[model samples]
Target: MMDYKEQREWLQEYLPQYMTEHLKDKNYSHFWPVLNAEWFKWLCFLTFPLILFQQRKILQWTKLKSSAKCPKKESTVFNDMLQPKRRAKSKAEIYSDIYYNKRIKPLVKAEEEVGNLLEDEDEDVKAQVHKMYEQQWRTHENAAKTNVLDDDEGDCMLDAEAITQGIDDLSIICQ
Candidate 1:
């Protein structure tokens, strides 16, 4: 097996030649505008060897502790490229995470608490709780409206407000 230094030397020698040949091929003409740029080629030449060095270090570290047998394979130039695995959040999930968790959940809990408070026996207490609930709701709405004026996260705040508007309408009916 080639060590890290030998592998890096080989990549340094081979990558530019391979890139030049590949770019000259008619089949890859579509990518020529990006791939043929000198800076991009230089970046690749620098980045690939560093990636190989990291992989070799990780393999050496793992081999010290684990008895697992890794399958041997021929070293190809592109074989060590890193591909990240990510699960993209859906639109609804994005909205929920950004808006519901930060803003709506507290409002919901407060509404539930107010509903419970409305069940108290004294008329004065019920009136006070109702007024407090209305005041809190208005404050929340005002805050949300102010947030809509912000440049960052404004869209998310607007969506949150839209959702709360429906809830506010429902609360009015309930009262």
Candidate 2:
């Protein structure tokens, strides 16, 4: 039955008291320190950047001292540390390396020989060798087609032989 003004005044006075009493209950007592920790939060916020700055200054000083003490040798220590150490090559890896080296040697040698031949001053010799290569390539291509048509089983062997012969002929011509 209180009038509006009186009700408002009563609530204003009573509400704060009610909240304080209830908020101190055992159930909510633990949350009070955390809820009131604005100063602690500000302390942390201010100190974090200071901590980082000090660390950076320390690192810089250490680096300057190191450089002054010794000229930096080509240090692979850190590089080796950062990179994973390689294990001894496996049998398969060794075999594959050997196979590739053997396979690549001839091609590299052939390239060098061809480079030498191209450097030769005689245009007629280059022309005759080119003609011979073309003739051999055409013959190989024709033989490959005939072998493919006549016998599927022997096609791979024939192609390999043709390639070997072509390489031999090229070596002879280059020499």
Candidate 3:
């Protein structure tokens, strides 16, 4: 069967003259050219609803005897997900990745970096700072063994006021 474009092409030769003659009485001048080709085009378009109905009837007409092929959709290329999935991932993997990543490595790296920072200090301050890190490393080691090293820890180095208050509080508690 011929498609709408083929049917429209055949009618287009004769329909323009018929439409222009019939619609010329209206006040609109701009619509004449559009209506010429559009009338048959629309007539063909109107047939599509019927054509679709016929297609459905044909499906039912030969339900048991005939096979028809339907159009296939192209499969999409999706990226492999990153480590932290947007949805529906294992929970233990999240905590395990962070236990090593966000917690342990940065703590150790910051402690090492602070030693690098102390290299620019006066010899007296550098010696004292190095000694402080030795004590901190021992505390960190013990904390690691106990398995109670805080997951909530940030940047490893204790704040100055907290360190001072800790020493003062220790002295008070000792007395």
Candidate 4:
């Protein structure tokens, strides 16, 4: 029911009093230019992390809980687009493997490949995976564009044996 100006005043009054300087010390009273410059610098530097913390808190509070999210059985928008990959083994087998994955110390590629396989399919349930996929897509596109200039992969060969051995040697040996 409160109007805009009233709400603003209420917020100004409700803010912490001690942290905010007393009424007598609002401006240049507290060491003026030098102290104010340092305060401005500190505020500017802290804003980035403070905003990040606020975003994390908003995500934690506003986002749906795991059980409340779209279930695996129901095909959702994301599942339709990605054509979700199926699990290779039973849940028990996979759980057992994961329990050992840390102890056994999986290779990076194996761990990454398995991670891709285990991702959720439900649209809202899997936003983090989508962001990761987008990041990886950008990295791969950058690499491919750079590779054209660098020719890092050169011409691929269908048959390594033919390239390694001389054609003349093979023809003579066969005869």
- Clashing pairs in model 3, backbone N/Cα/C closer than 3 A: none
Tell me the tens digit of each residue's lDDT in model 1 across 139-170.
Answer: 99999888654676545545787889989999
Quick one: ranking by lDDT, best first? 1, 3, 2, 4
TM-score of 3: 0.23
TM-score (C-alpha) between model 4 and the true structure = 0.17
Model 2, which residues run further than 4 Å from truth? 1-84, 89-114, 148-175
Which runs of model 3 end up more than 4 angstroms from their true locations? 4-39, 42-120, 143-175
Clashing pairs in 4: none
For candidate 4, write residues 1-175 as lDDT tens digits: 3343543343334233412443334332343344336434534435355656643543343223322432224555986789755757889787777876675446666787877874646776578777898999999998877755564556855587776577768888999
- What are the per-residue Cα lDDT tens digits for candidate 3 across 10-61? 5455344434443344233454465545644645545355766644543353
State which candidate has the highest lDDT.
1
Per-prediction tally of clashes: 0, 0, 0, 0
Candidate 3: residue 91 Cα off by (Å): 34
How far off is model 4, as Cα RMSD? Answer: 27.7
1 against 2, candidate with superior TM-score: 2
lDDT over C-alpha atoms for residue 138 of model 4: 100
Report per-prediction Cα RMSD to one decimal. Answer: 24.8, 23.5, 21.5, 27.7
| Residue 14, model 2: Cα distance from true site in angstroms | 40
lDDT scores in order: 0.59, 0.58, 0.59, 0.52
lDDT of 3: 0.59
| C-alpha-based local distance difference test score of model 2 | 0.58
